[model samples]
Target: MEIIRWQDDNIVLLNGAEKRPMGKCEAQAVSTLLVIKERMGEDSQLTLLGCAVGATAAFTGFHRATVSRHGPDVLQRPEKQKTMKEMGKKERARHIASKLTMPQRAFLVKEIHNIWADKKYVRVESLWEWAKANISYKYKKTYFFWTLKGLGFVFRKLNNMTVVEERPDIAKLRVAYLKKKKDMDESNAFYGAFDETWVHDGMAPTSGWQHANTTMYKKARMVDIESAQSGPAKGKQRGKRGIVLAILTEDGVLPGSEEILVDDDDENNQKADYHGVMDSNKFKEYMSRCIPEFSRLAASKGRPGVFIIDNAPYHNATREKPPTQTSKKADIQQWLKNNGVSYEAKAKKPELMGTLKNFLTRNGGRQAFTVYEFDEWADEVEGVKILRLPPYHCYWNPIEFLWAQMKATIRGMGSVTDSLPIVRDRALDTLRKFSPSQAAALFRHTRQSEDDVRGMLEERESVEEDTSFELLYEVDEEGVMRNVHISDDDSSEYVDFSDISDFDSTQ
Candidate 1:
């Protein structure tokens, strides 16, 4: 075969004949012609071998007759062409390796070739799995398979590789964000509102508690008409009772300015017909007295802050409605504004309620302390902005912290049968054990420290188990695994419980 150099030829050759020149020729066609000639033998004539010749002539330069009469037999040099074909695979492998990064190339070398040259770890599925996990791109797997085919790598059916791994950078970024937030909270003051909720656990005291208490025990009933007619003994029922003092504090710290009071919730109101803490007149009296007092306590001397409370029926209970048929929220707001205190009803949101629940739930419904020591609680505490913890996170409040300590101390102690003074004194003794200064110091020193932040992030970063193609298989009488498919289209269904229950069992 004549091994002619590649060039843009304007003429096409048929089996053994040359055709007239056709204008400008394509360079790729010229090269392909030279390649075909080198693949053919030396004395081969040009033209007439049918479709390939016609294609060659059509692509490069030629007339139809030359290609039809004399084929592409002129371009066959089978021996040398085989040599070129052999070089193609190795060259392609080199180009692919060159395209990869050092780490990726090394991974491929170690994983695919086992670099030791032993072929011990040269697993196609393992390589595919590694690629699927690490090489994240829309066309990565397709390109990878093409390259693998070009390399002559044995690619048996892999275990259906589909599990995509999370990038480490995402975890690193998340941890950084959490750390930043924790840092921001370190110097800032958090504030919240407070409220109380009572629940029944079933217990009742008879004679000694109070005349009012005894009356409540005798008077309160589920069936109103029957209990009213039946008399005291018939009305009494047995059940335990408990209360939750919810204080939503800012950043889980109790405000040193305010004190939480737990009192005997009066059950023996003269106007027991109304479904509330007090009757109309008593409700009005309560608002007129307590609202001003609480506002005075909650607001500052110079810039009195607004207080947020829920729009509960108890708060809006009024003796009369205006001609405009105005609601109680307006009345309360008016009173608060008149007294130099502003008020707003909190938005009904679960997140706010969650913060409150965090505090109240932890304290087991009891947060006892006296306002008498408010000065001592607030004294000399620098970097301590004593704002009310928002209305629900009482568990985080240090006052509740103190209360927790007290509750733990007296968990199994006999119930308080003594007067309110004795109970108050005992509570004071509990407070004395946990000094506010010491608690505040502890919080300042360890406030959402780096270690805590990391732990929180790690908990959040906890790996999600990969179950992308988890399959279930069962055999029929013919003994073939049946009805297999991919699992869990929704990412949230990924549970790490990791039981083999996901697989089919032969009965």
Candidate 2:
């Protein structure tokens, strides 16, 4: 085989493989040239080979093609390539570890713990902000996230509540409430959940497929009889607002429950029968009316009734009137006495209503004193017991979900105007259409949630259950006890309707 030096294109026929020795080619006669490159370094492995006849020009095409195809791989010895591929992961890990100092690592871990402790969202900026303040440098969010993921962190959102507004023992009672409520051993056991919601005029706002160019459901609903005859497209501005108080049961909305027509604009609006929004007095009145009707419904079914309501602030008939620091001791004691509240009264002290005047002579009026005249009154109602869903846990009440269905059904109807009351009429009409079985499905979900919640408590899964608040990502870092600090900027606005002219339909 003829071996030629590639750089100068000098030819030599090697008897075997070429070693270290070399010579110059001055007067050359090339027969069949094999252009081969020399190995320069101990590890250098690149080689060039070609077959050509006679002149340098004759071998150029073949030489170029051979080097172009395999030059780089040939130059970069495969053994060393394999060595890099093996150690690359470990080298990267070491580099990342080096980026975090001992103090920083501790701080990050603490911050993560603090975030989870408060059930707060941990943003990348918060971590970077912390890193900048304590770690002396901020890592890119991607890298920081990867590092966190390696440390067993995950992104999440709050789907339930876990607050301590109410006592844990009190909240746990809900499981028992759910257990007996859904299934009763007594033949004719009645269950019901009551709540109120406001409805607005116009088409219900919803997110759905619409032509890209078209507006959303902000358009009006047609209600006039002649206009309805013409077609659905002909319409006018609608009144989409009203308040409704509904009571739902496993069997569906209770019989005594009827839609009360609320006049959205004027409480005294003669056109509407029900006035304004639901208030404390109205709720009291509604409850009074409902008790007997509830009794009647139970009688019809030959069952005892249990009614559930939310513990809205309005539902509070009586609240604790503890003496404050600024209150006069005598006055606090006298007020409790005059209200006939039960408190620790000394035997020597005469009970004015039911408290000892000397009791205020101590630190303060008895803190244990409670006033629950409303609860007593509710208890007196025959054939029914009133229960409140655990604070922040409206999901415990299936009626809430039923209301969603009620609203969604209202939306499915074509445009609605003041001519047809969606809240008082159409909404109730849709609710009436719901079968007892269909409504029971929603109730079953609530029953299942009871078991799920009970399971969580048994497993010691969470300190609190999903009430209503959104849960975000949780971190497992330990030691740090500081949670995310939030500062809110609030502002209010109002529009002056007096300045606007009335609608001129004739124009």
Candidate 3:
């Protein structure tokens, strides 16, 4: 190939001695050369167009270095290399998109749109599925999601909802209180810890079928006196029947005040495969035995604190049902009238108590007390105060922490086959082994995370939005968007929103 120029200003290439114009296919080629020369500078002209020999070589594709060496040219350019790199990227994206099918194109567009539309932005994969079902399957699920993300669609989550931080002051205070109480020193502080746990009829043995069976039988038999006495003797039983007792105490080692248990293993309990009996007499018997401990705990060190408990029928012999029906709250009111414990004002929102009740019912009734032999147990624990958690506010009671810890520890342990007594024993033993510090540690781990707390606050703030701006917009008979920009003097348009809804002024 050869190239010739008219006075070196205009140049042309010749293949095998045939001259060609710098036009058509060769025009764009020559233009590129000129651009490169302008980029490299006038000094580079010789290697690019020194003579027919060099021109021919340049036309045939010589490296810029070779051209620069012969021509010695430098261009006044800021970032020629960077522009070329960006061009490559654009070309790559175009090439990939061109390979996709028409259905994929539509799906990608719709998925991006759907994610943008959701109040809580949808994830790319999830968004792609919606787009795919509604559009076409030309795109792969994973690819489509990433493709959209690459284009800048964002999937957002409430980042501030978790509790990232805690009030260290409160934690420090709790530690100080515990220490003071342990030392048995008097301080103005009302230092105390409260907790509640269900006592199963009995706990299952760690090993052996015989031991486990015995434990189950022991738990199944933790019923109150009425249920134990009314039923006919089983296999000619001779001694007084044992009673199952559920007591809520202060310290695990101390006896509690309020106590109740199954009177008998009725048909309901049997059907449910639970052999617990509800005996009011047995319940009363257990309560009497624990009464002194309760009194002692309440009057501990000559300082008295009111014991709080829920309004359970067994607590103070109140009406079983609420007063809204034929059964009046008065029935219960009368019992509390003489009882030492005073009922606080009923909770405004009882739903809060759901967590505690659900925990109780789900774990089999508090039958562990039966296996513990409460009367004998109470005789051993000198003084303990019993306090029932006020209804709908189980969260206030520290015992909620105990259950929370237990649930987390036994999250996936398989089903229980032995019996209630065995379950109770195992659970109680586990509880007994756990120190207050260990219990507190478990509570810390199980509670919600920091981000969760912040998100809730943000969510609460969002729900309470200002509506004053709503009056700025108005719709009329014409199907066109309009603004109601009324001034203070425009009383005609100042109708109350409620009244405006009720009117038909057009009629």
Candidate 4:
């Protein structure tokens, strides 16, 4: 007797201590012979059956039978055999996709490309949703996904290794900042870095000891047991928010320079972040109060002071707004006159704008027009200067590290049940503990970062200069092109359109 067992996608034939794998065709042939033998008893003649079937039945230890009981019509037909050669799963999916006309396929590919370009990454479900809405796709989502895969679409997680600091413009800014710092160091200027941060009463240590069998939740806060049992809606809030403005110098954190503003309004407390609570006006008011202390500290050191501040929007509030093409003619005229720029009395808006652009270009561009109010205020105090740090380069600011140390210390001593006042007090105490040695160490670390960035910029510039090449060609009257040699001093002149606005162009 022959026993056939299915293993995965193949058929295994076991017969009397012998076993062998069989293809689909061989298995079908064996099954057909077994059915024929069952229909016609073993006593019937075997010659009527095909020689192939008789041989297969004998090899598999099955008795051969004649087809006398049932006519030859019992055999598998040619059409049935043809149907067995149908397409496989993947082939069928591709065939379904091919049903769309060429233009339709092109349209889908273009739309999918556009979506991916805009979003950087997309999911199969999102593509399907878009297709259903835009193209009225009638196929199942799984089939659509398969079609996408067949068309060379693949899913992958987006990479986040790239950063803004790697850009050429940002690198140039870093180099310029380092050069300025170098000059300041040579002048023996005092560096005082200042920044703002926020904290909440729910703040706690990110790590702690816990039971071996239990999981630990960092920053977990205490909640009312009865209310939590009822539902999340009845649980206590995260905590009250406090915005802190701090200053740190080589001598240590300036006394009375730590200002903590607690959000007492219920509506404000419900907000996720506290940045909106502080703005340019509030920041200006705070600076007004701290400038005197800053001046005193610099005098004590007997060195010129350079107030290093990050380029926060609030810190860069303009004293006077710059005029644009959209400004009224009177406003533009007044601005030009105040800046001592001469223009035709009957000059149109566009002409006046052109005159203004020339004046600004000769000076320092739009930056010269937009002067920060804080910078002007700082200039009032002798021996004090304001220096804005390059954007996205927070490591260059020592106050940032000071804030981190203060927060860590506060979190380590804070409790979930602590009130806003307790949290504020803890933060103040932590700030008080920051010694001059710690502040100096942070400043040294910042200086090291500056050196590293300077090295990076120098290396990048060397590589760029080594690889830089230019091809200049000239076409003679005979329409023949040839390479043109030019000296380094022979520079081409081009119009400066950077300061030109859309409105100016239209005019």
Candidate 5:
């Protein structure tokens, strides 16, 4: 083969005729010129343009340098081909869709994630409408949904709830409170936490087992006590018609205290004083008497009581005052009856107010009430200096977990019944099994969660989003596609790069 050498603007065929060379080739063809420059110069071009012999892929770069650079494959970058192979499905889809407009395509992915983050379901039609409104690209709802599904997206139920972002101020206050409690606890005191939960016939939630292959699930059963009406239960025994009030401590139920049942039948029963559900008056009487009795028991064992309790309305530091109108007079009468205060039911408004105020003064008045009983018998009574968990912070309470375990046991029992005796016995039996060691173990779970929350609340100097707007896709359960929520704090999910298509145009 005769070699062709380039002169200024012309090509010389050493063994043939000289000819004027073609001008610079297309910008798109600059890359492939390196692949065959040496061979093209020596004899033939890469291809004959069409069927005519003279037509060929013309070279553009300087002859000597181009041949040298193109001669070795190792000198060139493999980035273009590698990028195509490693590109995620969503990324490639975004790129293809970007032909219409890059901004809209990029914006749509971000909007989908934003809608999902807001806990609003993004339907296909909604996304299609949004794109139509924002861009000139017209897309059918069906087409968009199908394309998204094909590109790896599935309806995934959200499982995480936004927790209260712990501020350093809030954590500081909690630390101070905790330190105060610890100082009080270090004395000769029995550290006892109290929480209340309502137990009814259907409070035990039954769980259903499903086979691994079952693709569809029916509606799930929910244990919603609030939804239960006062009417007779359908096709089943009546639910236990009362509240079970019990206090828990380290060892077990407070000494000399049994689970108190408050229901309709209590008012007409022997000890009329203890009948009915919890109210402000009933709560005050219980605190002044029942808790004091428990405190005595704690003192007997060489420990005063240190009660850890929640702040329910009945356990408020101040009680509400009753209005004195005829309609409201009955309210004060009811309060008197509930607290077992001896008073004339037909008494005038002024007389009734004076008597009630006197009684409230003897007990804990609205102004004087700290919700802690002042009893000097257990030595510095003031209701044993109660420690309160922060509002909405249930992670510090272990009794909540205890209630869950008891309910689980009740659900698992084959002989579980709504009948009073059976329900009462099962509940009491469950409570009896809660030893001090079990309480310690369960409380550790709460303690660990507290530590995790505290660690998460550290002052950060810099923060950033996990995403750089990369079109990421995730999958679970073998081909079940799920939309991944990427967080800077989470590093578990890996973006899938299985999707690839022809990128020769880009190459």
Candidate 6:
């Protein structure tokens, strides 16, 4: 073929009178062949008119010097190129492993193991921060976490001794709760979560900046008394605590729904636990007052409202108690009669239970036996539905997160000198400042947590069903998983750290 030609912004090969468009690969091939022919010699019959590097460059849209320099390498065998790439990758891996010394590497692994031993879950960011503070680690966060993975430390959910979470009953409850939540979500229902939290004047920020020379300590003073005669002097006076109840929705805290009950100054009335301050009666009153407004808000959005709360004892107080096996046969018969189910009066307790079970199985199963007062009240509300969070699954409630944010803000605004009134005001101010967008974000986070828990439950069920596939791993005392063979080798360390260099410490 004649020398490659650039025609109308297109590379074309010219041969006598015929011209054909040359693609990128074709141009590269022709350039590589021309370079090979020139290297061969002028006597070689294969050299039909050696192509110039400048012309090839113009045809391929590459610089003339680049064509001349890399054109010969283009003829290099593919196997050799692949080998070079593989060698580069191996060298890169070696260089990365050499960044930390063996001792430093061991120290990191030990620290992580210790953390997992004490805590159920630890984030990589927390580990990175610990390394920076304790070991003077100067590498980027990504590299530090990558090094942890290389040492056989995986960022996975660790199994702890949370027997309640693993219980079959609780698992069923979680599955049901997820199903209800999924239905509500698919129907675009409005979500509102309400929970009670306590805040005391002694509450302070967990962390803050301090002067290098001065130590900041949290200190509180008791209420002053004029004389011992003044109603029997206070006994080790404590800061007042407030019981706060609030309704949080996707649009933020409902207006006029926040209620705070400050502890009485009287010594005789104070209780050891905050739960004593708020009872079923008070909770019922609060819900009665706020739920109507919540209904109206949901109606305005043109969607049904779901009010979620945890299964606190007070929240689950029944309007009517269901008869248990220990109850009298008369009581069981009466219960069955009250629920419109007919049963033999003279039947023994076992037969009565069998009949009751059959009836309940048709109607909502065991849950139908007892009707929660809160559920009854919510039923009366037009557009609102009550959802109790599954046992030990309080994280599914977005209000829990809202309460956390409120307390954090309150503590940040408070000091040792703050009184109950001041703390209450600060909490109310924080609630006021919590915007709709922030509440929406919290709801999104709660939804994600729900999804994660659902996935975990499904995975557990699948694993349980597949008996042939046993997970061949055991968790050690440090919460690290190991293969049986690896666990048996006591001579080997938990992690091999010789590959990591000590460069960070030197810096």
Which candidate tops lDDT? 6
lDDT of 6 by residue, 422-459 (tens): 88888888887789999998888888767765665556
lDDT of 2 by residue, 84-168 (tens): 1243543333334344554455567677667867867788878766766776654455556545553345566655445632454
Model 1: weakest 10-residue lDDT segment is: 366-375
Instruction: Single out the weakest 10-residue window by summed lDDT for candidate 5.
Output: 49-58
lDDT of 4 at 414: 64
Better of 1 and 6 by lDDT: 6
- Which window of ten consecutive residues has the lowest lDDT sum in model 6? 227-236
Task: Judging by TM-score, tell me the better candidate of 4 and 5.
Answer: 4
Instruction: Report the lDDT of model 1 for residue 46.
Output: 51
Candidate that scores best on TM-score: 6
lDDT of 4 by residue, 25-115 (tens): 8779668756765577543345544343354355555544432122133222234311212646544444445544444555667676566
Going through the candidates in order, what is the number of backbone clashes in each?
Answer: 48, 13, 58, 0, 1, 6
Q: Write the per-residue lDDT of candidate 1 for residues 1-507, one digit (tens) a residue.
A: 111222232224332534433334444556566666666645224543223544455564656555444444444333432232244555434333334444443344345533334524444555666765765312244345544543334445654212211333333433443454355455343333333332221112222323444455456554363443222222122112223333323223232422223334454432222234333354344334433433444344322322223323444433332212233444444433443543335623343334333433343221211111221223222222223222222332334444455544433232433333434444444444554465554344334343444563454456463221121222333423342222223223322212222222111
What are the lDDT figures for the candidates, one per model? 0.37, 0.53, 0.39, 0.65, 0.52, 0.67
Question: TM-score of predicted model 5?
Answer: 0.43
Off by over 4 Å in 5: 1-190, 202-205, 208-238, 265-276, 288-305, 317-379, 414-417, 460-507
Order the candidates by TM-score, highest first.
6, 4, 2, 5, 3, 1
Score every model by TM-score: 0.24, 0.47, 0.29, 0.52, 0.43, 0.59
lDDT of 5 by residue, 188-305 (tens): 5666666655454543434444444332221121344444333332322234444555566667665444464636552235232222466667666666666776666666677767
Question: What ordering of candidates by lDDT runs from best to worst?
Answer: 6, 4, 2, 5, 3, 1
The reply for model 6, stretches above 4 Å from the true place, is 1-161, 210-238, 265-273, 337-346, 350-368, 462-507
Model 6 CA lDDT for position 324:
74
**lDDT agreement of model 6 with the native:** 0.67
